[model samples]
Target: MAKKKKKQKPKQGHPARLQQGVVSMDRVKVGRGLDALTGQFVQWYAEYRDDPELALMVLAAVRETLGVYAEVVGLNKVTDFDPPKLLAVLNSMIEFEETENPEAASNELGTMIYMAWVDYVEFLRDTNQWEREFESLDWFQKTLEAQDPFAGEDEVEADDELDAILDSEEASIAALAEITAMPISTMGRAVLSWVLAGGSSLWTSLPIDQFVETAAKAVENDLPAGLEETRKGLAVALVLQALEAVNAVTLNPQAAPERGVRSQDILEPEDADSFDVNFYFIQACLDMLLEQPGENDQAALEAWGLAALWIVEAADGNPQHAAAPRDEQWSSEVWKTAQVRMHELRVLGLLESGEAYSLPNIVRLAVTDVDDDIFEEDDELDDETLDAIFGPDDVDEPKRLKRETPYTGEVLQLKLTLKDSKPPIWRRVLVPMDLNLGDLHDIIQASFDWYDGHLHSFYENGFGGTTYGPAIAEMDYQKNEAETLVSSVLKKEKDRLDYVYDFGDNWEVRIDVEKILDADGGQLPRCTGGRRMAPMEDSGGIGGWEAKLEILNDPDDPEYEEVAEWCEDFGLDDGEEIDPAYFSKEEINANLDLEF
Candidate 1:
């Protein structure tokens, strides 16, 4: 959760300058100054298509308004401000804010944003875009005497893909109802609010990521009348929806010949190897979230990543992974619903369709089970093919095994130096030969006494191996750090590696394998020696750290006390001066013993 900061006052002389353009008037006088500003805002909104920077300023201004009157504002935090909604709110605020009652501007903007959100939801419903949600409603209302006014509206035809999904979801709900003995009405109501929020379509689509950014804001702000429960339900419903999206292909039984009457030949790996389709699908979702093409959409990626993981766990038959304070049986019932929706995705055809999809890896790895009759090698292989497959009889004979070898404990002595340092803050450590890149991450953090508070990554110098880091970075690189071994990349002494900590600060560390040792029966992965304390957490890299050092050295500096207090928080001092050039080999080894 992001902590809300105190709103700083607007720049000096801002209101004074605005007063010249904003004519003195109340909400009653719309034709005067307010209308003029609305026109200007609308013009800027239109111009945003060409000038993104100008659009960003408008978003910042809206955020400023939200931040200033956060307590009174009813809209959720505007994470990714849609240009049109911002335009609408700007126009509405201009109408409501009187010259004398400037505070009214923030209130009006908040209300308008909330209204825009509601209208957007209504629009989705009106268009029958809420397919998942509509199905939920249809299930419970079947017995009602009051005829649905939207029945004709529902008949509005959907494409084959969408129709397949609607049919699958309906089937899933029915199956779960039977299996769990849970009433359709109860399940329907549980997810009713979710349907209104655009459901699964909203999530996998680009907009859901933007919407999630405002979730904290939604939690803080007051929802419209009778929507409190809807807001609350979103807190849980999103998880279910995200999982369903991640598992859309696997849960579809019709994709496989054995599971359904359709007898579709689902793709599978040709060899004995079986790829974890669920894992790759989740990775693809994470990749999409991390690449967030729109504005500040990092929040969306994180929310979706969490949901994907939960869904994958459920699909693997471990619903306990999402252990919230809910009925375990009900949650299992939901899992069954996802399972039965498998036919919704024709994964084999989709993979072969050559259509651009979010998960290319999933497409690449997807294969179909070979026909047993066609694959019978005895009948299919020609004399030449058999000869190629088995080689000459004498040459094909197996070689005898050599005697057992003794364990040769190998250690890599690495020299890590902070990049761009004057006096040169560095460390030397010896790690085991078989340690993976993921474990090495811990060693580097401990070597520098870093708390591992932020994102980090490793790049092998010269070699084109994938970059390894936090989940988002790994997803972006389409690689897993845990799967990469240290010895695989760094083979001998003088081999170089680059480690970067805290993407924001970009604290780069240059790592060189100083020596490859035979271990000499010594305990492995202990820091052998040298240099300074790590950079302060959240310090803006080398430049910021240097600036802080300057402030600490000068008692007369106005910011000295603040810097000192921050250092104190890190347990650097009681009254003693902070030491940048301090290293503890013993402490490093002790930590390594526990960590390794």
Candidate 2:
């Protein structure tokens, strides 16, 4: 008879298995504060539990609010509740909602969450469990009152009419025609006057009648006077709105078109806070606007010039007083000055023109023109002069030739190794040579189970070489990663690239082209092999990772419990100690299939 296998004993502190998909709470651990809080919550919940709908609503609100707080702050006790912490959580929710769904005026889920917190706080006070007397609910009440739908119903209705007019293309065209008919000098002077009176702020804050009156005086035109009740008034209003919109876009490229621009976004040259930079940016925008012939472009330029002049006027006081009187000679001098500024702006890569007429939408301004002719050898200049102009001889290296493509069915087997990782945490992936760098970035993220919550970049040669990444305002990049194909950078078996994610932690990966092979007709861009688990994001880089591994390896370590808890929080643990050498090729490939 075969010997019977002995039943293995369960390990100490092992979590109980789920029964019928229900998690067993018998083995779950709860902190003293959490236990007390829950006990009170249960009693409070019982009061409304008779009405199932109200009870469910309360439960969901409480769960979502507490859940987000726990996710953001790792809140494990009632003592974690504080005004600043709550404020941070609230801001995160608002920013996320705004970014994900810009059309929504307010986050309803966030409102519910706040309401739940208020109720919980009230419960704590009634039960006499509240110890932080300084934390007030008055601010929360005021915020809720401000968000009340009925508070400003009439004002909202009035604004709706103006908003509709602004949204209408026909109205915009009429307004543009009116603006274009006015002399450029008149427009410039109006802008100057508007700037002296306090730019967009004063205009946006005034009543409609007052704003129309002010606009008329600035333009020295009688068209907008007493026309606040007519179509002409709407034209004036549209011009003001367009000016404000252009100003908003100029200061912050990321500012949403529909939202009200903040005062903080506007940088005054007289403020001494990065004044020179702000002033130059404004000048660059004006120069760019002048390059295009679109009526909207001209109008935007006038608005921008007004802003620029305002900065100058505010700094030095009434630029007209400096005395080049309005004349044909004065106009020529002004034109020459603008030309010089335009050339400077272009050389700095701070200004560029698009194919169509639109508002001045500037993004990704480079400090220095990467393709400047100074890098090219000059036959007229001697070696010393050439060296002075071009820095050094070694810097004038030949540019890499891009691969000529009518891409064949080619696959690149890439080996991505985490930099400075001992035992070399790595992954082997097969990707199509024609795939864009952005998609490759996604594959890399998925392979390592990275959250992709931070900024990332690909360097063609190395960190200081040609950069490929998302286009961010004021950031210089050689090409957009989403538009650059992998073959453009890596065309051979041995070609390599470097990638870095999370600038703070600086996690680096070196990607090498290990093999060039013909396509096998299998699913492309799939992971073939990898070793070890990826380090948790924000784990303080390699040094912190090493320390974490040391603690994880030894259960008896003083900080092992805390470290294990953190791992659980990040979903790195599944009721078992995390293995340092863990890797699953099938799992990675499955994820890659889903991603690709």
Question: Using TM-score as the measure, which candidate wins?
Answer: 1
Clashes of each: 9, 0
Q: lDDT for model 2, on a 0 to 1 scale?
A: 0.51
Native-to-model Cα distance after best TM-score fit, residue 534 in candidate 2, in Å: 1.9
lDDT values of the candidates?
A: 0.44, 0.51
Candidate topping lDDT = 2
Tell me the deviation in Å of residue 156 in model 1: 47
> On residues 102-148, what C-alpha lDDT tens digit does candidate 2 reach at each position?
66435465556556666665666566765554324444444433433
lDDT of 1 by residue, 497-582 (tens): 88887655678888898998887655567788877766665556788888998999899999999878766544453476766766
Which pairs clash in model 1? 76-217, 77-217, 251-342, 252-342, 252-343, 267-367, 267-368, 268-367, 268-368
Off by over 4 Å in 2: 1-408
